[model samples]
Target: MESALLLAPKLVSNPSREFRSNVRQFQSSFCGKSIAIVEFTRTDAYTNHKSISKITSLFSLGKKKVKTIKRETVIPDPDYRIPIVLLGFAGGLVYGDNLLAAAPVGLLGLLLLFQTTRVKFVFDDEALEVKVGEELDESGENVFVGGKNRWKYSSFVNWELWWPNFPILVYFKETQTKPEGQIHFFPVIFNGKQLYDVMVERAGPSKTSGPN
Candidate 1:
């Protein structure tokens, strides 16, 4: 009876069988967890790499694609040769004894006589260029000076035209320090309507107010 009771407890316990079942469950769960972790890591890495490649490609394309296209026009400056020459001659007459004073007056006369009477307007998609100079080209036409200034299209705000009284005035947006914006005045000689139309088309339409 004592031997049977001891044997009964051993059969009920079954330690080896329970231990084997726990080991199998642990191995199956660990394998599944490791596979899921590997898949998540690989997916994350691929997505990050693809996004980086696309951004790099966009920057490369922007750098290569930028280009500039330009056109040139010559507008004659208002003829003031008569007044300039007269003023210079008068100055020389009044200061005849002073070579220093007379020299400047004489030089002024000569300079004005030879100065280019036209302003060369160069237009690019980006900016407007103004060049003032008197150099002849191979074809015997007056060319502009080497140096030039540009007014960007982005700075422009609005323009006004007065038809027959036609001096088109263009205004730019003001900054904090400058209460009044910069103003550009251009006198139209050829065809006011046509020139205004072209300017509006190229400059991308703005508030055009008044023949006033």
Candidate 2:
């Protein structure tokens, strides 16, 4: 006898008051009323995680006021048949019921705390499953995938260590230039040196040109 399989699409809920409330609370406390989102540049000839962190420290981290930055990036598929990609930044999923804001914030003390490290990676193709690694552990890396190409988890050492670096309060200019604030996260799938090596190798090469 053959068995029949019932296939149903995964369900996603609408935005919620709880999230809006959190957003309100976040906005009031965080200082994010405008467009956030830092420009995550692939490590340049003169920069590395440490240098980037240094630059970040100078801006929002300076005055000690937090900002809530939200960002959305849409990846277009050349095949049009492939669904357009939508990536919601930290604290966003909560609003849309896609993820719980409470869990992350309770532990990390506001998503903005890990701005450089906070990211919501999204894969829209029905055929794509994000390859989803073996097991997810506790770290600030998963949510952002910062190391792989250019993402949140890419620049963090440990969420704990990265926390203080996030700007508590940030201000945005109407012009929409530069990141005012960001989201934060901890380990979700991969961990430790494995994560580090992946980023470094993909980063191509160190700016230092030396002997063969």
Instruction: Identify the candidate with maximal lDDT.
Output: 1
| lDDT tens digits, residue span 75-194, model 1 | 334434443654577576767766656666676555544442543444456665555545422222223312224556556655565443544333333122133544555433224445
List where candidate 1 sits over 4 angstroms from the true fold.
1-117, 133-148, 164-180, 189-194, 210-212
Residue 139, model 2: Cα distance from true site in angstroms: 18
Q: Tell me each candidate's TM-score.
A: 0.34, 0.17
Which number leads on TM-score? 1
CA lDDT of 7 in candidate 2?
22
Candidate 2, residue 23: the lDDT equals 16
Count: clashes, candidate 1: 0
**lDDT tens digits by residue: candidate 2, 1-212:** 12222222111132221111111111223443432333333332343322222122111233556686643332211111101111233345567675665355434533232322333223222110122212322233334424232233232222221112331221111111114433333332222233233333432222322111
